[model samples]
Each structure stands twice: as structure tokens, then as C-alpha cells.
Target: MIISLSPRATLLETIPFPAVTVCNMNGAKKSVAEDIDQNQSNDSDSLFEKHMLRKLCRDNELMSGSKVNASWSKMQNFMVKVSQPCHTMLVACLWRSEEMPCHAMFNPEITDEGMCCSFNKVKRNFIYRNPRQLHGLNYTFPYPSIDWTPESGYPPDAPANANPWRVFGPGKGLGLTIVLDAELFDYYCSSTASVGFKVLLHSPVETPRVSEFAYFITPGDEARVEITPKISTTTPDLVNIPESKRRCVFTSERNLRFYRTYTQRNCELECQSNFTLQECKCVPFYLPKDSSTRICGTADDECVENVKDITEKRLPEDYKNRTGWEKPRNINCSCLPSCVQIFYTKQMSTGKLEDMFNVQKSFLGGKNLSYYKQNMAVVHFFFVENYFTSFEKGEIFGFTDFLSSTGGLLGLFLGFSFMSAAEIAYFVTIKVLFSKLRKNQRKENITQTRIFKSLPFAE
Candidate 1:
């Protein structure tokens, strides 16, 4: 035992430690090291998560679908189809009701004297009741207004000063379908000895789509208005997309003068109203009429006729040397449709009805059909399949745009990042203020020491 022991051996022999306990202690140390490694990995993962969240937020700000850029080159495609019955049927029967008084019948007692009576006579009876004596019948029903609904009845809830017979249907179906009944047509023919009807086939789209139609009939006799639908497809050079999404940048304000919002229909309507005002000294009741301006009435028929004549007869040569504001030699009011084009091809047939039958048992009964024997025509109108087609234009910025913008900003301002911005804020709000406060305190202390020295007193 007297053998020389090294310092390590002597230290181990002095401690009352077992080998198994030392092994267990070493295992505990390994476990602690493993926990430290896991913590480091978790910290790296958290940093990665933070970076991803920041990138996502930035991407959402730039690529959110709320805003769009204006561009002229952008384009969108639309396919519209309208399905309708091949043989369209329009039953021209009198819409009659007791509520609607007959102004055509004259009082026998009042007219017996053979004296001149006032033109504005009292309507004492209903027109349908005295069908035999329907000479002075006025078949001109008032046009329906924009808000007019058939559910509200014949006389709509309208303003007193508003025009009557301003009949306007809401809107047509995108792909419209219509069915024709031969039995209904036959019933209309037998129900009235004579009737008046006009069949019009036009695009369901509002104004600026196309004002003209193929089939037009004047009030009188039983007739058939047939349309062999033809399509005139137009792919406009320019297109309109939603303003909320994108808009045209190159178009001038003067070019879009008619519409404040720049829609084809609005522009056309505005142009028409302006033309009417210039020619007739009044706007049509159907068009927008200012309160100061009078609406065109029956009295203004002559002016309307004159305007129509001027529009139809003037030649292009006559327009030479005239200013743009000056009325064109031809009363040409050109309002081009936007990108959408709708064309209707029409054909017609006509015939006469010999006898009359009871219309109360027909489909036209509940609709309040009024009869006028002088005008008789069963007009049918409908659209064919694939009736409408539209094209739109729009613009957008993609992820590449966002990356390019970000890179540009970064290149333009080197060393500028969120950390740099935070540092700047800290400098301005905390570091600068602390420096100023220390400087002021130093100055104040110096001043106090000088005052003490100047007083020549020590406490």
C-alpha cells in the first residue's frame, strides 16, 4: 500500500462513490444535454414560423383581390345563349275590364238634340259591354314606367305628373325560352272579329345593345309577325369590364361625355335625350326630362315628325363646314354599342278573322285584355338558342409584380429594413431624448457649482 498514488487516484479513493452511481450520474448529464439540443431545435423552428407568418401577411397586402389596375389591352370572354320556341305565338286579344270605362260610347240623350257637344265627354259606360258600337275607341294604352308591375293592376302607383302608357318590362332572361300555343292563337282569332297587334323581336339587353328591331307592326288587322332569327356577331376592338375591377385609361372625358359612369346604354340614352332637346325644344317623356323643360306630348307630334324627317333626309355633303355642335346635315345621332352586339332577323305573315267568340274562357282573360276590333294581329316574339355574347376587358397585377416592386424599393433604399426602421424609431423617441436630458442636467449642475463659487460660501 506504500506504492506512490497519482493525485487523480488519491482523489477518487478519498470520495465514498460507487461505480453504478457514477454511471447513473453520467446518464443524467446526457439527458440534460439532449434537452438543450431539443430546445435549440425548437428555437430554430419558431424563428422559421415567424418568418413565414411575416411573408404571408406581406403577400396578402399586395395580392388581395380588392383593387385592380387600369389597362386597355386586357380582355375577358363571355358566352350567352337564349333558347326559345321555334314557332313564337302572340295572341292579340282585347284586354277588357269593367274598371276601365268605355270612352267611345256617346250618350244617346245628350246627342239627340243634334247640337255640338264638348269633345271632352263623360265616360258613362264600359267599352267591352258595347262592342257593336266601337267607333270612337281609343286603343292607346299608356306606356308602363320603369317600376310598373302587372301585379299592381292597370293604373300603376305613379306620380300625377308622370306620363301614362310608359310600359317597360324589367329585364329579359340571359338564355330566354318561349313557347307558342296554336290553340291560344286560334282562340284569339275567334274571340275578336278584328284586333290590333305589333310583334317586336329585339335583344333583351337594355339601350345601346341595339335600338332597331326586325319586326315592327302598325296598329290594325289580324296578322303574323315571324322572325327567321339571324345573328350578326361582332368582336369589338375595345371591351368594358367592371369599374370595380379595372377601367380604361386612354379614353378621353369628351369621348365618354354621355355617361358619367361610362356604360354604353347610359351614353346612348344621354345622347338621344340631348338630340331630342335640340330638335324638338323638349325631351321625350320616355327620356330624361329636366324640371325646367316640358315633356314632349301629343301637341309636340308635329315637331317630332319634323325632327324625324330632318334625320332621314339630310345628306353627308350638307354637314360640311358645320361645327361639331351644329346640327349635322343628316339628323344622324350615332351612339355605338359597346362590345356587346345583338341582332334579330325577322319575317312576317298576315290574315283576317271572319267571326267572334267568347275570350273569357281563354288564357288572355285574367290578364285584363282590352279589345279593339279595328286592329287585329296575333304577334309572337321569342329568341333562339345562343342569343347573346359578351366580351369584357380588365387588368391585374400578379405575384411577379409584387416581387418586382419590393425588389425595386429595396434596391432604391439600401440598408432599409424593419430592424433599421425600429432602430430609427428608438433613436428618435428614446436615445435622442436621453442624450438631451443628460446634456441639460450637466449644464444645470455646472450652473449650480458656479453659483456656489460666486456666493463665496461653503456649507
Candidate 2:
């Protein structure tokens, strides 16, 4: 019988057979059909063996092990629950495994400072710190420059030998100091905020006499600040201004007329920890159990604004006792600066792996503690379990610490070996080169002395 195998078979399932033609002694078509049936069975056995080998290799520990591995059918079943921005390659492997926790790999990246992670976006911007009190939006500005030209020949009313300095006093405020047009400054702030981020503005230059600082808050948007030197005149009416014991107003030498200049003071505002963990139970927020934390009511607006206004009035002991000052600050025509921006729109959350996986527990030595503290602002959001400044202490308590003990020991050994070897090699190379050069110089000097003595005797 002549057997003809189809070329459409998969590589793993292909049967080992040669194509053949039946002779006229027997019906050629019937013989070919029998051979084709035999080859089909052979192909099935090859495919089954290949499938088993693949499964075994993928599951072997320390061979081809991963977090996710399973039979083909099991993997397909797990795919129904996959719905995040995490790596598809990981998901593809994970679908085969049914035992994996959804959040097994969702932990944050731990830096010296804290946990850093990229956000859930098609193109993710990595956040090194937790989103906290100091929120900011990214902004860009053109590189600034100033071009100066003197008027050719003085005007008819010019004082002879007059310098430009004579026209305006340095104290009079109009020399050649650079001041941002208020419109451009405010527009920058507003534009940054429009992209769903909080923004703070500080005057680029000091203007000494600013009574009411005028800057465009956004394009075509304007904001004014009023400054008063008198302590009793009332601190700038802004919401949630932290109270300070000193009432002295900071003064600078910039010569410009402004009623007030906005200064972006950096500070931390924290959510007070409640004795017990309750759902969204945060300071400056009311939680009555029935109302969702997200469902903040109209009364919340009044309370929040009051907290801001009252906090600014560093109420003296006497003022604190007074019933009248304790009452919420009245909001009228005066608009209070917003402490936080609120958006009512829903946004699709992008999913990403938390960055703190290996480093937090493993990476150590050097001034890592201080380095972490400096950059703590970047990744403080995820390791919110413990507020300790030290990661070593935090690790002991298991506050978002995910690194293995072995990784830490290995890292320390490698770090010490690298530094020690570098130092020893550097010293040895320097010593050997110096010694060889000194020996060569001594031989040359002796030869030159002998040659000079012989020349004199011959003369």
C-alpha cells in the first residue's frame, strides 16, 4: 500500500512516512487511502508525546519554573479573570496555573526611599514615591533670556554723562530686574492642573512692595495676593494655612510693586491615624459608616474650609478659649485658596506591578538610609503600613517588605568584594610601577657618571 501524509500536520505531530504510488495490480486509489489512515494514527502519537514533554519542562522546579505554569486547558480557564495592565507574557503563563493569588506580584518596587511604581497608563510614568501631601503636576517652560540695547544718543532732556542707573534708584525698583508677567505665570499653573494634578506657584523673583500680587492663574485667568505687614491686619486669607508662632513677614530686596506675592511654601499635611482601621476614616474627613467616604456631602465643604481658615490663625491661649474665634471662619466674598483639587470625573485605572519587590529588603550598605529618606517623597505611597523613617526597622515589622533574606546576604557580600578588590588592585599597580621606574633611573645615572669621567681623561 502507498501512504501519503498531508503537509498540513504540525511540526511536533508530523508522521515519519514517505509518499508512495499504488500499482495497477491493485486499485491505486484504494491502496493510497489505507496508507493515509495509518499515518494519521502515527501523527497523533507524536503530538501527545510533544505535549507531555512541554508540560513537564514548564513545571520543573529550578528547571523552567515560574510563578505561572499549568496544563493547556487549565490555563484557558484562568484567563477569564485576567483584566489588568500587567505584562501579557506573564498572564499567558499564569493562565495555566490556578493557585496564584491575583495580587501575588502586584507589590510595589522598594527603593532606598520607599516603594516606587509606574501608574496604570498605556505609557506609564514611574512614580518613585507615594502620592501624598505634596502633589504636583509636570510643567515645561521655554529657556529664558534677556536682550538689552541702549538708546542711541540720549534724549534732548538727558542729563550729561547720565548712566541708566541714575534714571531709576536700585531701591526705587525699576532698574533691570527680571519679573515674570503675571499672566504667563498663572497660565502655567492652571495648564498643569488641567491634566489632573495639583500645582503650587512661587514667585520667580522677589518684588519688595507687592501689596496685591497679580498673576494670570491660567490663560486669561488672573489671581491677586494681598500682603500686609501688620500682624493684626490678619494673615493672608488662605485656607488651611499652617499656623506658625512667629508673625514676622519675610522681606526681600526685589524692587516691584505688588500687593501680595504668592509663595509656594513646601510642607506636609498628613491624615491622622485613627485608633482603629476603619474604611476611609481619615482626618479632615467625616465617616458616619452609612455614608461612603467618597460620598462627601455639602457639609464637608464647609468643615474642610473651616479647618483651613482656623489652622492659619495661630490662636493664642486666650484666643483658643474664646468661643467666637473657635467658631468656623466665615467665608464671604473672599475666596479661600483650595487645599486640594477635586475632580468628579471617573478615570480608568491603569494596572502595573509595584516596584518595591526586591530592593527594599535586599539593597543595603553605604548611606542608603539617608539616600532613601531624601527620595522617600517619591515612593512613600504604597508602604503606608508603617510610617517609620528607617527601612531596616520597617522590614522587621514586615511593612510592605517583600525581599528574601538570601538576596540581602548575597548583595552585601558582592558589594564588599567589589570595593575591596578595586582598592587593593589600585594600590598594588601604583607601587609596582613606581618601584620599576626608580630602579631604571638609578642605572641610567651611574652610566652617565662613568661616561663623563672617561671623556675628561681622554681630553
Candidate 3:
């Protein structure tokens, strides 16, 4: 008769971390490690090993530069829980609207003092000195010529009488003295008025793209510029606003009418100048209060309302039916499909640098920054049970299997040799026990026969 024997061995299988507890993504929870017995029951190990492994795992968090995996397990009667790692990040606007045109020259000097007339001497005298001084001083007379002044060609009287000009005094440098001398100004009373100015408008549009500019004219320093929308009639050149800087121009004109200085306020929202020639202010693009058109759907709407809506809506019913339906499933991928890219901790990668800048630009971005910062620490968990099972059950496979199996050849040889030695010891022990049993049986038989012969006489 032949006896068939079943060998006893251990096999391991890959299992996801069992459900232990539900951990809120926003909930603050401390990390913990657990040990299990051969039957997968909780067992305690020395504090040193657990502490060391945890420290090692933590130090190798992905954000910390190393990509090592950690471990987790489900509690028998409780819930298996883990922190959800934040993935979405933002890249902020690095460029700003630069050099917004402010004050400009409207009537740049053309044909010096054409309005001077012969009688303008009194006005020129007034322009050169105070009227009180002219009347008070003793007279020294050689009345200057009225017709075509040597240099200006117009009579000197023209400059004095001209509403825009005044005697500012010698050494102080002569200039047209008026309250309305903004870089660009319009006059309703004068004919043949020369109006030249450099107009610059602040834009939120990004660089490397062409955009249009709108011009508005207003009377005072109001927050809003009440502009009369004209087509090409009031259009300025479409200048290239460089990255992080504003556009500039040196413009001059001798004729302008029916226009007011394009005015703006220096307040918080409307500080960005609308028109005229002035130094440009480097303001950020798509500010919270900005009304300018933006490329990312109304420059103000960073998330594109559709994307915002998706994030705001509750999980769909169909999704809820899935194992992880209560929330969005965590799907981590990398440039390489075969590589298991695990998120180890909340960390900021180079990718997040741009996002930080974008968030700083707006109130919403500011609020979100805090959230991203808190969630940057994450940990990835991996189970080694499958590896151990594969090794024990001789089911090694995959790219790792080839190397592991090759490296484990020595262990396999040693294990087999140990088993063979044990078998030989067992066989020798069994033979000795069997031989002793036969010898005892023979001695018992002889004693029984001797007793039977001694009792024969009585029979």
C-alpha cells in the first residue's frame, strides 16, 4: 500500500489595505503602525522596530524627495481610514500690466509762439512779470515792435493774450501757466489748436497675443472714465505690451479740438489709467474688481464656472454605488505607465511655484492657498504580503520576480538542504524504534511459551 501525503506551506497574496476607519480629508489624525501574528491577528512588537520603520517611511515621503511606501491595515471592528492627498494645483500669473500712460504732452511746441501780436508786448510783459510789478515799476520806454517778432514770428502780444500762456517769471523757466495742463488736454474755445499726447491703456491680456484698446474721455478726476465709444476715429496704435511691463510713446500734435484730457482716479480699483500719454503703472492682470475681458473666460473667472460647478456638485448616484463612491477615487498616474507613482506626503513640487503666485493675485486664490498647504503632506501605503506569498509558493513573476528569484537562489538551496537533513534524521530514528519493538515482541513470545510448558503437567 502507498501513502499519499499533502505538504504544508504558506502562500501570500496582495491585498489592498483593509477598511479600518473613515478619515476625513480635512480631519486631523495622527499616524499609527500595527503588527500582526501568523494568523493575521494583532500582535505587539518592541517599540524600537515600529518607531524606526515609521521614521524611515516618513523621511522618504515623495515631497521629501524619496519615494518609499508605507503600510496600513483595517481594524477588525472599526473602520480602515487614510488621508486623501490633494492633487490639483494652480499656476499663477507672473506678468503684470506695465507702464500705464499717465500725463502726456497735448500741444507740443510747434512753430514757436505763433499767436504773438504787436500789442502782445503788454501781455508778454505780464507773462514775464507780475501785473502788479509792471504797473508799479518806473517806466523805461522803447516799446518793442508789434508785427512778426524776430524768433516767434507772431506779435509778442499773442503769447501774452493766449489763454494757455502766462509769465511764470525768469530763472523759474517760462511755461504755459494753466490748471488744465495734463499731458493731454482738449480746448473748446481755440481754433487750429494743436493737441498731441501719448495714450497708454492698462490691459490684463497675457503677452504674445494681439489685443484692442478702448479710449474714454472725461472732464474730472472721477473714478470712472465716461468715454464716448468711437470706432477708429479715436483709436490709438495697438502697441506691444512687453511681458511684465507697460507700453510707452512720445507723441506730439499741433491741432486738436472737442476732446477732454482722458482722466482717471488714483483709487484702489480705478488706478489703472484709461488713456492719455503718461508713465504706465505695472498692475496685475485680471484683478478681482477688473472689468477687462480675460482669455480664461472673463479673466475674473479662474475656474471657468463649469469646472467650479463640477467641484461643487455632490457625487452622482451611479458613482455612489461603487466601492469608493462616497468621494472621488484617487487615481495617481505618472509619465511612465508601468511605474507606480505613489503620493507619499503633502508637499510642494516645482509645479506648485506658479500656483502660489496665481493664488496671491486674487482673494479666491488666497483662500485656496491655505487649503493646498495643509493638504500637501500625504503618504502612500503598500502591502508586502503578496511578495512573501509569491516567494513561499514559488509563483514569482514580473520584472521584479526575475531579479528577486535570481537573488533568492541561495536561500532556496539552504532551505532544501535543511529539509533533507531533517528527513534523514527522522528516517534513522524510525528504524531504531522499529527494531527495538521487534526484539521486545520476541522476548514476550519466549516467556509465554516457557509458562505454557511449566503448566503442562497439571493438564
The number of the candidate with the highest TM-score is 1
Ordered by TM-score, highest first, the candidates read: 1, 2, 3
TM-scores for every candidate against the unseen true structure:
0.30, 0.16, 0.14
* lDDT of each candidate versus the true structure: 0.31, 0.22, 0.22
Q: Residue 352 lDDT in model 2? A: 24
Candidate with better lDDT, 1 vs 3: 1
Candidate 1 lDDT by residue in tens digits, 1-459: 011111211111111110000000011122222333244444533333222222222334423322222111110000000101111222222211111221221111111011111111112121112323221222222322222211111243454322212112111221111111222222211112322211233322222111122123333333433323322222122224332223222223224422223234445555656666786677543343344555453345455545544443444454344333345443554444432232345444555433364433333422333332322233333222222332333223445567666766875789566676688899989999999999999999999998988875558
Q: Residue 184 of model 2: what lDDT?
A: 19
Tens digits of per-residue lDDT for model 3 on 1-459?
A: 111222232221111111111111111113322331012432332222232233223322322322222111111011112111111111111111121111111111100111100101122232222323211112222333222211122343454323221222211112111111111211111111222111122210100010112121121211111111111111122122221221111112211111111111111112221111011112122111112222121222222322222222322343345542243332111111101111111111122222334432331333344543432211111222222211111112444666556547745866545566577787799878988999999999999999988885653
Which has the better TM-score: candidate 1, or candidate 2? Answer: 1
- Scanning candidate 3 in windows of ten residues, the lowest lDDT window is 110-119
The per-candidate count of clashes, in order, stands at 27, 33, 40
TM-score of 2: 0.16
Off by over 4 Å in 3: 1-341, 344-429, 455-459
